[model samples]
Target: MSRARPFPAAATLGILALSACTGPQSALDPAGEDAAEIAGLFWQMLAGAAVIWCLVLGGSVLASWRGRSLWQVATALKVILWAGAVFPTVVLAGLLIHGLRLMPGLRATESDLRIEVVGERFWWRVIYHRDGAPPVTSANEIRLPAGATVEFILSSPDVIHSFWIPPLGGKTDLIPGRTTRQVLRPTKPGVYRGACAEFCGASHALMALTAEVMTPDDFARWLQAEAGPAAVTAGPGPDAFLRHGCAACHTVRGTEANALVGPDLTHLGSRHTVGAGILANSPAAIARFVAHADTLKPEIRMPSYAMLPETELRLLADWLASLR
Candidate 1:
């Protein structure tokens, strides 16, 4: 007999790497109760399919055997009927009922915490709502208390976009002039990755964010800090910001930069990433982003400040970094 070809090592390694699925963004990890339920359903369906496939294949082989008799043919026909017809109908019905039962739990009714997320062309405008307090604005990062149900009211100002955090819950669409909502109750305290699941525009692939699940006490502290205004500092950066006509589209608390065309830079320094989570939040990164935001995220609305002098760019970056 001819020898079989050996499996390629490189291909095997690549397949294994893909199957790892250990990232924080993976739905298979299931960090929350809702995610766990979804994952369980997926596994159940997969197992059912495998069982049916094996039964059908085994019956076909047995029926085609050269020595098969009438008794074997009858048995194979019976197996095919049960595995292909009865089994599928029963499994689908069960799945449908189970999914319907889980629907109410996935919906948001009333929550102690609510967050409004507006989807822009390639970024996220986040607003935190608290009782008897002014709304706090942030961008590209969502912070929530672990073990508490939080509601997210989502909307889009332009094209349709979808908000999805795989380890927490399902994808919810953000349509222009229409509002949608999703409820999440994370059971783990960790950082999870989120992204725009819908194709909106050129920079849609780069429209990503981070969800930080923290303890109740820590979340309270963070919320309090975020509600406050940016710290005041004396620097040439403020004058340069206004000189460059940046105030017409951005906002900085306690300053005259109250325009709303872009994300609020009032607490920019406190964020972990910039350029819609495309760049790390550092002095050097900020400088590059300020000069070449369009280069980092193509087709963005922000203009490139590549014409600015090196010193002025550095000064602007420093000023933004000091906002925290």
Candidate 2:
């Protein structure tokens, strides 16, 4: 009896899966110095594994099919001893030493920019520590100057979360009451997705952030703008945002909406996403999130304002969108 094969389907699926290894969040498609070294290590290890696999499997097939005619018992034993044990040991030891050699460069701490990223529930609170100025606070999104080494001081206030931007570097856990530092030198100016790699709560999977790498001049302009107050100071949206008790949690630097319970809304309109990357940054999305945040992100700390009138929601969303 003969058996049928599914090689065509398997081959198609394998190609599709491999195609996913080259995107914004792919470690294999690294865009930074640390990530490039990590990717190199991965490829080297993969090559070593492939060589070992081919040799071991080929030897097994040859032994089962034609070994008796080709080798004496003593020679076969010698082959098994060296091939099964000694070869793997040497290869793995070499790989380990190569991996260890990369640690010092990856762990270098003398950075040009310092940013503190705090994991709170399902959102990221990003604070920029400038050289000669007070720390600027933002949320959900991080911007870095391309070609500069940036150090991130990571921590969590409640539970453990892992800060990982695959295109840049490795994952660093954010443990409560303690800090973990990771340095990344971004070489590309593009938007990369970041996420919490640890499972923390009901909405852990939705905890995502955007990291945009910019040129030095552009980053300076952005930082200057972000350090300032809200661009839209007075309007119907600002009025509704404050009048409906939104000020109790959020902060809009130029206005009276100064509270730290929620994400800093000082430049909320400028970000790419709402509710920490759960929704696109638009007037309608903002209105929907403001009215139903709990539904959009499960078990979140933000209270829902489902009762807000549609017109008011639109106004507030417009005001926030104009804040840039």
Candidate 3:
């Protein structure tokens, strides 16, 4: 066999690296107002650093070219003093001022919508607090209206978890028994990924969420729909879900399965992911997750339903998948 082409391998690696620069989770690929500001600051700071680097590099080259001359040595000392200290201080101060100006916008408490997000062990609980309605409860997904400022009231019930959606803005820490806040204004209607930036436990890496930005009209309709109860409450799946004691932990509104120990599954089927983005939402995925919750997401509070019969598991999955 012929040896692999070195140039081709390098090119492939370069392509892979470049592909990461623009994606759903990239901070540089900003889709929101705050993110755009952050990206601009990043580029400006990078340029300042580059200028400092060039000045120092050029001075070093001059010193090397004019080696062993006392006059040139004095000149090099002056160059080092200016390039290594004065230039960096001024550039850093300017960048710091630019960065500080962004803090007020991020800290602005006034918003068109207020969302309370509670971080659990390996999942998220989302509650929308609209002005004229009771809070709407959901899980694992966040929906926002494009071009509107949204204030996220964040907290963790157990450990510290940093909630971050890089394409939207910076990370905010969620501490137990204390509330923190972050505000973001999305300018584009698109799908993005959010994650728990802090390490919580065995399944910390799997703690992920999806954020979808919609138009004002579309978001209002979705929120109205989400406020209602499950569409399928009398099916065999509901029966099986109750029979297996899943109701003790989960709540499917408009039915007797009301409990607050776990996430509300009233509209589980409507969501795009199951097990907090570990699997796509579908009957097969639901069945697999129901049958082996522990294996799918280790250390989660939801116990595995492996003891349930295969037929009942199918019924449960089908019924849940129709929840939308």
Q: Give the whole-model CA lDDT for all candidates, comma-separated.
A: 0.87, 0.91, 0.90
Model 1 alpha-carbon miss at residue 249, Å: 0.9
> Which pairs of residues clash in candidate 3, taking residues 3 or more apart in a chain or in different chains?
none
Which candidate, 1 or 2, has the higher TM-score? Answer: 2
Cα lDDT tens digits, model 1, 34-140, are: 88888888788889779878877776787688445736777868866886689888878988898999999888597779999999989999999999989999888
lDDT (tens digit, per residue) of candidate 3 on 1-324: 998899999999999997988988899999899999989988877887798688768767976897667357677678668866887788778778877888999989779999999999899999999887799999999999999999999999899999999999999999999999999999889889899999999999999999999999999999999999999888677888888998998889998988987888999999989988889899999999988999989999998989888899999999999999
lDDT of 3 at 15: 97
The TM-score, computed over Cα atoms with residue i paired to residue i, of candidate 1 is 0.90
Quantify how close model 1 is to the true structure by its C-alpha RMSD in Å.
3.1
lDDT: worst 10-residue window of model 2: 1-10
lDDT of 2 at 116: 99
Residue 93 of model 1: what lDDT?
90
User: For candidate 2, lDDT tens digit of each residue in 96-178?
Assistant: 89889988876686999999999988999999999989999999999999999999999988999999999999889999999
Clashing pairs in 2: none
Question: Candidate 1, clashing residue pairs?
Answer: none
98 in model 3: Cα distance from truth in Å? 0.6
**Candidate 3 segments exceeding 4 Å error:** 1-15, 70-73
